[model samples]
Structure formats: C-alpha cells, structure tokens
Target: MSATTPSKLEKMLKAGHQAVTSECGPPRGSDAEAIKEKARMIKDHVDAINITDNQTSVTRLCSLAACIHLKLAGLDPILQMVTRDRNRIAIQSDILGAASFDIHNILCLSGDHQSFGDCAAGQNVHDLDSMQLIQTVRHMRDEGKFLGGEDIKRPPSMFVGAAANPFADPYEIRVPRLAKKVAAGVEFIQTQCIFNLDKFERWMGEARDRGLLEKVYILAGLTPLKSAGMAKYMKNRVPGMDVPDEVVARIAGVPKEKQAEEGIKMCIEAIQRLKEVPGVAGFHVMAIEWEEKVPEIVEGGGLYPRPKLD
Candidate 1:
C-alpha cells in the first residue's frame, strides 16, 4: 500500500540520495520501553527503522507492535513481516493495521525456521514464501484486492522491500533470484550483512549486467563487529554469512577491549567502498541489539545530518 503520508525512504531514493536504514530487534518480553529506547538511539541517523518479526525464529514482541511504538515516537518504521509465523489472513490483517497507523514500509520474508529459534516444537506456516508475500503486499496495494480477488477498501500504502543474500551459495542464482523479487514488485532490497567486499562487488556487477541496477534500490547490509569473537561466530556459525578470513584476523588482532571499536571502523570502511559500487543505492547498517553504535557508524560513514524531509 502506498503511504498517503510521504515516506522519507521513498523520497530519498527517488531524489537520488543514498538512504540509510537499520533494524531494531524487539524484546522477547513485553517491554514497550525497550522499543522506545532503541528508537531514541538511531531515530536521528537513519531514514527509516526496520522492526524485525520474530527474527532468528525466536519469539518476540510482534513486529507490528514495535513499528507502532517507533511511529508513536516520531520515527519512520519498516514493519518486517515473516510468512513463517502467520498465514495469509494474519498477514493481510497486519498490513491493514500498519497502514491505518501510516506505518507503510514493510519487509516481507519467509523467516528463519522455527527449529533455529526458541520454539523448536512449533510448526512453521510458510503459506506464502518470500516471493509470494512480496506479491501479496503488492497485490493488496496496487490492485486494491486481496489474494482471493476480493476488493479491499483503503488498502494500505506500503513501501515494499525484500532481503537478498549476495553471500549465499550457487552465486549464479543470486542475481536471478533478485530479479524475481523485483519482478514481484519489491521497491528496495536490503542484502545480507556483507563482510566480503570482493564477492559483493561481483554480485553487484552481475546485478548491473542483468540491468537490475535501475529496477530497484539496493541497500548493502553492514553490521559492526562488537567483538572478534562475534566475528568468528558469524563467520563459522551463521548460515549464508561470509566473513572473510582476513577480516576475522584483523579484528582478532586487536585487543579484546578494542575489538568493538575496530568493528565500527570496519563497517564505515565497507560503506565507503560500497558507495563506489554501481548498483548500490544505500546502506542498511544492522548494529544488532547494539543500537547505540549506529550514530557513530552513520557519522563515520559521512551520512550524518540526515536530510530534513517534510
């Protein structure tokens, strides 16, 4: 659904400026204050904030609730909805709920498997995969109809986005997969957190060759390493994660107390280099739960003093 109210994200990208966005993981417990606290940390620095829906399959406060919290705090929020937890009915209900509040930016995902999260016994509900979910949102918005061909009144005006993984296997399929998302009507793409620039550059080149550079806005994901141990964990433990060996060594070489500082430096470096990539549209700096570090990353990357949009 298109937001009747202006979206800073859509405006920034359309105006040809690189947009900056970040993710905020909602608290597992019922804590409205937690969401507000995180909002205060990065509200001034990012064009929009993405509130994750049960990320990593772990149960948390629903993304819609968190988005409302951010919106009430005067922040633009991207409501991240995963198909794993909800069926088409719940999804559409959430879309309507978010839109009524003018929370239009939504990121659709298939979600991490429940097995990986707190509820291993819980069954998944992937009634619509990521691609289908994207199409569903687009359908509801553009056609003014539900998935069942029923008309919808005042359909939410959503700025649609989907995730991409340049670091995923069978690199040949990465660009093709992205093309599918674009064809499904995604307006923006926030790629997997990138630590391997060479591989990301190659992916960008392929995306450009496919002429997708103009089809959608691409936001490269950058996460600061809070510690060398975290780097090593992401390198070895996280699926689809591609932390270069040298990067691990670089952070590991630093003293334990200073590794976080080094990680921020690395993130800023990634943003600078990505700016030169032809298809890059912006940066999605995911500082994880460490939201306080975002301002420094935005500032260090020379994205400070965010645009004063109306």
Candidate 2:
C-alpha cells in the first residue's frame, strides 16, 4: 500500500504480525534536507524506518528528533536509543517525550563501548543495558509508574525492540542471551548484519526450539558491502561482526565498478533465504550512506507492496 494510507505505523506493525521490516541510517549532521530526502525515498517501501542513535558512536542528530520528523513526514519510525550518554533519568524522560509526540516504537540498546567510537575519552554511562531498558519501558506502560515509583498521568504507548547478535562467539552463549532478552519483555528484535545464512538458520532453529521465536518479532539485519575493502574491514576490524570467506571471495572476484551490484545481489539472496526461515518476521536494511540503494534491494527481494487486503 502507499504511505498515504491512514494509520500507517499501526498498519505496518500489524502487517508484520508475520511480515518483514527494514531500517535506514540517518546522516550524521543537522542537514534536515538530507534526512527528509532519505526518508521520502524509503518511507513507502519499508514497514518502519529505524533512526540510529549516534550509530558507530559518532555524534549526530538525535534519534528522537529524527523520528519525530519522520512521523511528521508520514512514516513509521523506530527510535534507536543508546544508553551511552544518558542516565536512566534522561532515558526515561526521552521515552516520555517520544510518547508525547505520539511516536511509539523504540529499539533499546546499550550502544558501542567508548573505546570503539571516535571519542574514546568521553565518559560512558551504561546506566541500563538493552534488556533492562526493555523492562523499564514495559514497566512504564503497564504500571504507569516512572523509574522512581511516581505515577505518570498517562503512560506512553510503546513497542519495545532490542538487538541480537547471532554471530557472536560460542553459539551456546549467544542463544541463551537472546532468551534472556525475550524474557525481559522485548517485543521485537533486529539482529546483527548477517552474511552467513546457514549459521543464521541454525541460530533461528535453536531460537524456535527454545520458544524465543514465539515471543517476539525477529527482523534479520542486512548491510550491503560497498567493496572488498569494506568486507575485509568488517571481518577484521568491526567487533562483534562476522563475514564469511565465500562472501569476501564474491566481492573480491568482482571488478571495482561492479562491487556495489554484487553486494546488493548478496543482500537480496540473504533476505530471500531468511524469508524461508519459519520464525523470521522480516529484514532490516542498514544501508549507511548508501540509503538510496535500499529501494533496489527491497525490489530485488521480491517484497514490493502487494494489493492491500480488505
């Protein structure tokens, strides 16, 4: 359906009751024009847009503010929240603020460690981890109580999301950790960028057996590699990320001019295979500066809009 359809956010989430979702990264500066352009490009194509909270630990326009802008533009946005700079007080306040703006979706995260970002010297305040943040949001909504036990006049309606890394070392550990988050009340989960579908399928199978899949929405993350160098950088330097050798070879075999096309092809293949997995809810595309290529990937995945059901 077109974005002009009424109650787009509600409609999108309901569709994803067993559907797919994707995310876009906002630019790093205050150029509202750039953000608006990016939003307009993907708004109709995706079930929801996720505004990153200082992604890669670089300072940028606030996720809450960006989400508000997307809402005004008639797109559903999932505000990505990181606890790096805010105390619980500030985090709770932002939740209430977003609710007041009628923005209800959120992705709770602890953010990157200080050492990983450009500002290593900055103090890191991990006042709450992702799981704790999910519980906190649920508490606020269910009890109408703030963190301090004070009653809120009217608690904000929120759909809580969290991240999971299936590629982490020791599948044994990662699988159970996902269960912990599900137990903590996360309503949805966007996974780390997946390059190895077999491994992801194994993880998903285990998730289903453990009963985690039944409790939350799972959106597989796919980031298109820009070049062989990027593939290597992600494999070697990016912590908590893994790219398989076959994928690297595919990018390496490609001519420099064709690298982006090869990358998109690889992403489409991943999304297709992920769709076949029983517990998979959708895919979340993190295109970084290549946000414009998202439409191609979405179409390539054979996920373009179908006729709206009555």
Candidate 3:
C-alpha cells in the first residue's frame, strides 16, 4: 500500500473516485512516434495507460521502455510484466529498471502461450507464474529485498495489479483464483473483456461474498465490439474471453456501415450499467487497435477528465 511515489492511477483510486484505465500495445518496431501518437490520443481521457508486454506473445518494443516513453510524454504508464518470457532474474531486474524510469504501476501477467505468437517454437521461461510474480514484486517493494534476499539500496515502490477472467471455464473457481492474487499482494485487478454482464456481476458477487472486493480495486475490462466479425472472433478465437450470444446478435443486426457506431454504443451502455454494480471500482477499457475511439468511449461512459490528483 505504501509506494515511494504513487502513480496517477493509484492516486485516483485512493481518492475514492471512479477511475478509467486503458491499454496500448507497443508497436512491433522501435517507433517512438507510433507509441507517442497512441499515448497522446488517450492520455487526457484515462487515468493510466497500460503498455502491454509483447501482448499475445508476439515480439514488440519492451513494455518497460515504452512506459518510460509515455511517462516522458506526460502520461502515466502501467508497465505490464509477463512471466512467460523471462526468468526471475530478468523479471526482477526489469522491475528495478522500470522503477528507475519513474514507472510505478505494475501489472503482473502469466502471458499468452508462445503458440499464439510468431514464435511457436520458442522456449518459454515461466520461472514464476502470475501469482508468484505478484508476490515477487510485492516482496521487492515492501521488504526492499530481492528474491535472493539481498537488500536493495532503494526498493521499487509500485501499485501492483493482476488480470482476471470471470468468464473463463470452471467459472466457479475464478473467485478463489482472484483471492489468491489478493493474498499474493495484488492491489488492483483488471479483468478480461466482458460481454456477459450477468456473469461478471456474479463473479463480483462471489468476490464480495469472500470480502476480496474490499481488499483491492476491481476494474472491469471491456472492449467495444467494432464489428460483428470482431465479436465472432472474440467469442470463437480468443481463449478465456466470453462474448455473449446477445452481443454478437446485436452487432449482427446492425448494418455493415453502422456496426462500429453500434459497438461503441453498446460499450457506453455497458459502462453505464457496470457503474451501478456493487464492488465494481472502475473500468479498464481495452480498445485493442482501435485506440482513436477511446476518447469517445470514455466521454460516452461519462469518465472523462479523470479526477485530479491531490
């Protein structure tokens, strides 16, 4: 709970205000302008922007580097660290490096399997799972010591986070899984894109029952379906993602030229509804490649002009 310097997103949540966060995947190449353009588009509209760590296991500019770029560009960045690509040494080293850049918000992820990325034959080095990664960072921050127990001259203080998927299979187990993350010292959780509100609410209900909601912030994930094809793709292709049939049907009902508009409208409506759900702290909008639409969606969801940090 104590950070050497709290991130903008941490400050917003601590102020007891509803917060809005978004994600920005780093480009495949080292194009700072491409990163800056995307960051600038959504900076004013969100409390923090998540720099994905080679999202989908594909090669990309390092998330920590991209985060520093965003910080330099006047935006708060959440540096996502995945375990699939790094061993404990590299992970911890990167955490220290990221902190040096004033990137204080960290999201620990297990990452997508290599099969999904360009490196199907690549070797994975999940020396630690997501839960262990959370614990590792928390230990480094709170104890000011590395996993090897050497004292750190200066610890990396951070607002720690982890992802969740309420719609994933064995649905009943999701709540307990989240509880474990909390126990591992996750301060907040951003879930996978949700189309099944009923399911998300139920997940929240379970979280509430277990008193997990009170322990950490919960930011529900949502990605506006840009087209019926996108909807179908998520429902069929994306693992651990659940796009309800009704959502697909609604998008399908819309005319081809207007589907994008309809998709945004759907997201707005979902935001309005989720705001009223108990234990729902805020939202994490993952617009994917449609970064430009973030401003509209945030404004439409009535979360613009993110609360000022005191």
Per residue, candidate 1 scores C-alpha lDDT tens digits across 183-237 of 9999899999999999999999999999998889999999999998999999999
lDDT of each: 0.91, 0.82, 0.91
As for candidate 2, its clashing pairs are: 20-282
In model 1, which regions exceed 4 Å deviation? 1-5
Residue 68, model 1, lDDT: 94
Model 1 global lDDT (CA atoms, 0 to 1): 0.91
The per-candidate count of clashes, in order, stands at 5, 1, 0
Worst 10 residues of 2 by lDDT: 1-10
Q: Write candidate 2's Cα lDDT for 150-216 as tens digits.
A: 9998787877889999998877888899999988988778999998788889999999999988787
As for lDDT, the candidate ahead, 1 or 2, is: 1
Model 3, residue 272: displacement in angstroms?
A: 0.4
Tens-digit lDDT track of model 3 for 180-254 = 899999999999998999999989998999999889899999999889999999999999888889999999998
Model 2 spans > 4 angstroms off? 1-18, 306-310
TM-score of each: 0.97, 0.93, 0.98
Window of ten residues with lowest summed lDDT in model 3: 1-10
